[model samples]
Target: MPQARRKTPFSGKAKKQQLQSKKQNKTLLMSTSSGTTSYDVVSVNYQPTRGRGGRDTNRYALKFYRETEEELKIKKEEALKELIPVPEKDLEVNPVDYFPADVSFPKRPPWDFNMTPAQLDAQEQRYFKNYIDSLQASEHWKKMSYFELNLETWRQLWRVLEMCDILLLIVDVRYAGMMFPPSLYSYIQAQKKDMILVLNKIDLVPSSVVAGWKQYLTTAYPALRVLYFTSCPAYNLRGVTSDKAGQSNEDFCETILEKADTSFYTHERYKSGVLSIGCVGQPNVGKSSLLNALMGRCVVSVSKTPGHTKHFQTIYLTPQVRLCDCPGLVFPSTVPRPIQILMGSYPIAQLREPYTTIRYLSERLDMPKLLRIEHPEGDDTWSPRDICDGWAKKKGYLTAKAARLDTYRAANSLLRMALDGRICLWLRPPGFAEHRDKYESCEEIKYIRWVQALTSDQEEQKSDVLTSESDDDRHSDDSDADDDSTDDSETAAIANKFAALAGDD
Candidate 1:
């Protein structure tokens, strides 16, 4: 007590610093405003635009780490004004309403019922603990989550997550955030496991946009690493062989492999240095394609169909690393069905009442222009039915009896078009803006740029050599011309000598 009476000089400063750190950790970077960040203004007036497109309602705002107390209060007031309270009984939105009426919603068993404590094996026991921990940690899971996984699906996922040292979370580059499950992310972190986020369909999005996503994802999940890849054009190169072209399917496939394989993964559990990486993602995220490319061959089944892998399978790549492919799990979606449909989780072929999804797509993308529907009359706005009928007629899809356009076929075709990357449905980063000039990338993207530079240097060298060879060909032609001229003079001299001899005779 006597010793404690002598207060440490720096104790107060240290405690203050500790408190600030804790406070800062809780604050999330929300949004930034270029217009006026001035906190002095007591009132915030948002003048709604009254022009074409109805006031630019889709304008995006940037989120910052923190805002002033006054700004926070203003935001709260605005939010409160906009928010209309609903009865507690009517709070829940039925997910089935978002989907087609024909489609039966996948039933979810009670979370605890799936794996009862008495029925749980040793492995199941571990997964149960992880699940409980994840639920406790994530408030979003508690409120919004609905597990679509059956017992078999849960068991497969549990096994994959349990066996693998690293998880390769593949997400469609267009809708990475939408597809990525927050519960799984929280679960992985809770288990202290490593995850490498693979932004799979990179070709569909611009490199700039990929960089933006990379930066944003890295910021959102600090524990996970990120990478970008696309196997479509690369994996599906028609007949281009290594002998014919230096950059063949083989080479492009290697680049794709390097993109994911090059991600840093290490764990102390693998004392033998052989690590298992589990590939997990929503169906149609190119999980099989990615695994095939990484393995340098099609070890797993590659298909256009989602949920192609019905069960979990492991293929050994090398002594150093192996890939564990689990069935493509569709996690509970809080998002609307249009988003789910667009994400490729829904079977495009079996889509009934595709009008809603068609409308959603039509609004975002200029469907009339894209589908080249020159109407009977000059009309800008077209209904889903109109667009479908127009597309059906253009594509030669007609009903047998009425000879009317088969709108169902046309709708399916349009959905496939978006999926096939003919018509892009790309999404930008959450923090994306048209006005922001400075492009920023994450550490992983910077690493990718470094790898790209190396590959580009090789191409540049080959081009330089070709240029030098062309220059040498020009020099050789000049020397040949000089030699021809010398030979002509010798021939002329010999002819003159012969003429003089003939005159003497």
Candidate 2:
């Protein structure tokens, strides 16, 4: 330590310079070892071409001396790995975009009207010849089912519609408030063809309501010719049981025969030899049910679940009335998110509380009054459960344990009421009563209740006098002064006035 440190030749600046020299020498030695002479390597030059304004334009020139077979193979492999036809280095120009500046959009093909009277006689003769030739070549021709409204299905349906001789459009009266998809309806109208609008599920709604639905449809959709029908007629099933095979068979036969007789009277106009009827409607609107009822046999399977019918099935109803059952037509993806959630068709099932909708509908539709829920004290804040509990208590469904309300049973009772059509969710639009006097009437409600009772095996235990008294109490202030005097008139008149006061069912 006393000798003092001697100054070294490799100081801080010198050490850096020595390191940089070593790196350079190592690179040179490495290149030389690989037989790659720096002087033999080729160099590329970039140049710019002068324009009229003396501005230089960018361009590049590549110069190569020689490449080994291994290098060429490696380049080919690299190109193949990239899924390119050739190496990027070999490409001289960029691929041009093939998309046109003015691309023509697709248009709906025009309806083939070669057979229309407007065509020339010679053209008509030629069309007829071709038509007969095609028919002769085909194995068979059947009506298109309504289920083909999906994009893929619609194509096949359009083809069938083009070839068909007649189109029968079946509409549910219950869905009269919902508008038909314009594109589809317009296609039907463009055919300039006659369509028979079947007001199905008449047995579910009141006859007066059915009439109002029909009148509303007729006035709104003037292009469509409509007919009313209650596919299931009221039957006297006083002692019928599901276990009685023979009785059930007889009942089915009798029901069919009666329907056939009625059809002879009402559907006489559609008795032509080549009628093609296509049944369509929203899910669970009872499209398949009506078809099964009309067929008198299970030609198409019916289920309580909606969207069960996925394809169209065609059945012959006499040679003239060929019926085609389609999958229920729903607006492809236009169903409101909330409605879809409530209906349980949505994938996510966002519905946390369905009772909210039920309660709102109950209030808006005057459901408590419709079902005749009695609250002697005149309380207005009654919940849906309260109504259900009251109904259960009245119907004797009390629990034996704590004398608590049997709410689960009560809820079911409410569901049954809706299912039985005692509470109609859809109704005729406003101004309809003024233009058409076909608003729902009381006799119709009684008829619907009687039919529902027959089908569900639920007896009409509540006396008519009790129901009338309850109605009088509820609407006492609004009741007409001559109501008691009007009791002497026919039941139809009294029912009509009661229905008018009840609003649309």
Candidate 3:
């Protein structure tokens, strides 16, 4: 530091050279306005003068144009105006008339008390959980919600649609017009949003009718792109034996994998990232079973009973394809008593008179004409009792007292028929005549007979087993020769009956 302080470049020529070098390194900024330009020099000065501590000092200045004081004030005022306070409103007071006289309402009776206390509790918990779960699923869609379309539900749905990327509109081919409202479809289209229309329960109708249904849908919903799926494909277990179960399983897996791969490969959405595929349908429509079939595994639980699946579960098919499985949506308070009975949610065993509901539905839906059963000679209109008696006599549903028709049992049988879709009440295709031949022919008599035979065989087998067990118990208690002989004879007769049924097959 002392050596530096000796004034190494005090000469005027050296000082002038140093100043010239500094000037060359400095920046010259230019500003132009109103067809005129002004120049300003920004300098970085190095001062060699030593301070009290013997340190060199340096200074830098950047020069540019300055606005007038009045202009600066105006600009600041404008900014302040732009930031004006957002207005706030006071909360409204609740009206006295809005309060209920009794704040607490009585709890509804338990629908499943036939089960054990613990079982009832568990079922109730599950039902409540499912109800809550259904509500929560509405979060997935902006414009569509599970509950009945009311002011509150509509508002919530609108909020959901506001944020949704795609809409999956599920239309039940059976109840097409009633299930999907025109306003809802119009609203979806107005948004210019992507939509995938799923024609659910294709298995319920004949494959031939599907073409006409598709055509009808296209005409009805020209904007919507439709996709077809049967919830339950006739489970094809051909060539699969007990010994080859493992091989058959592998083959099934490979088949599903190949189909999935092909679908993925051909799908434009898979190639270019797009919206997901969401599955939605009415109760017991086989949405869950279809998912399991498509996935080639038991990913979703499938039950013969309706309303088993009560939540929207999302499964990832690929990086781009996510399948959203939704709960079976039931229109609140709109489901009729007969429909509930058919769904197995209402137990037939618990009813005081099971046939009452069945008879009501039968007469209302005209089941006699549908079945093509001619009334006794001159009878114009058949009563439920007459139909039940006739059906019982024909089906051999007779009482032990005599060969007379057991109307009680006949009612049960008729209920089973209606539930199984063997007898169609309120059967009509969309945009067609009420009693069209195609709709009439939807009843597969052969398939119904097959199902009936199978059901009858199962019942016979159960009865035979019970009778054999009772006979065995009686023989175990008795050592008498006659009793033993009678038991043996009874067992042989049961075996013969089962053998005859098996031989028929």
Could you tell me how far off, in angstroms, the CA of residue 448 lies in candidate 2 after the best superposition?
A: 14
TM-score each candidate: 0.56, 0.44, 0.41
- Model 1 lDDT tens row, 1-505: 4556664244464556445334332331222334423222110111233223232211111111122566446543432121122232331222232222222222222344355444444344345434433433443432322223233455566667766888999988777766666557667787788989998766454445567776676777788798866663233222222121122344333323211111123335664878888888877788877766565554555655555555567677776877888777666545555666677775666554566667666666666665556552356547666777776665566677998778777777677666655556665565465412444333444444332232323323321001111111121222332222322322211011112222433
Question: Distance from true position, residue 109, model 2, in Å?
Answer: 9.5
Cα lDDT tens digits for candidate 2, 393-488 = 554555669877665555544543443344444444435445444354434444454333322222233212112222322212333422344333
Sorting all predicted structures by TM-score, with the top scorer first, yields 1, 2, 3
Compared with the true structure, what per-residue lDDT tens digits does model 3 show for residues 1-505? Answer: 4555453435565556456435432322222335333332222122455323332222111111232356446543432221122111111111111112221111112443255655743443444334433533443222221222111122223333443345565654443433444444565677666666766554344333444455555676798776665433333112111221112243333323211000001123323564456565545555665565456455565653444443445565556666666544433222334444554333343333454455545544555544434453346656556666655554455676876667777677666555444443322334344334653255442332232232334333432111221222221222231222333433312222122223453
Q: What are the lDDT scores of the predictions, listed in order? A: 0.52, 0.39, 0.41
Better of 1 and 3 by TM-score: 1
lDDT of 3: 0.41
Model 1 poorest 10 in a row by lDDT: 463-472
Model 1 earns a TM-score of: 0.56
Say which prediction, candidate 1 or candidate 3, comes out ahead on lDDT.
1
Find the 10 residues in a row with the least total lDDT in model 3. 258-267
**Candidate no. 2 TM-score:** 0.44
Give the Å error, residue 328, model 3: 1.0
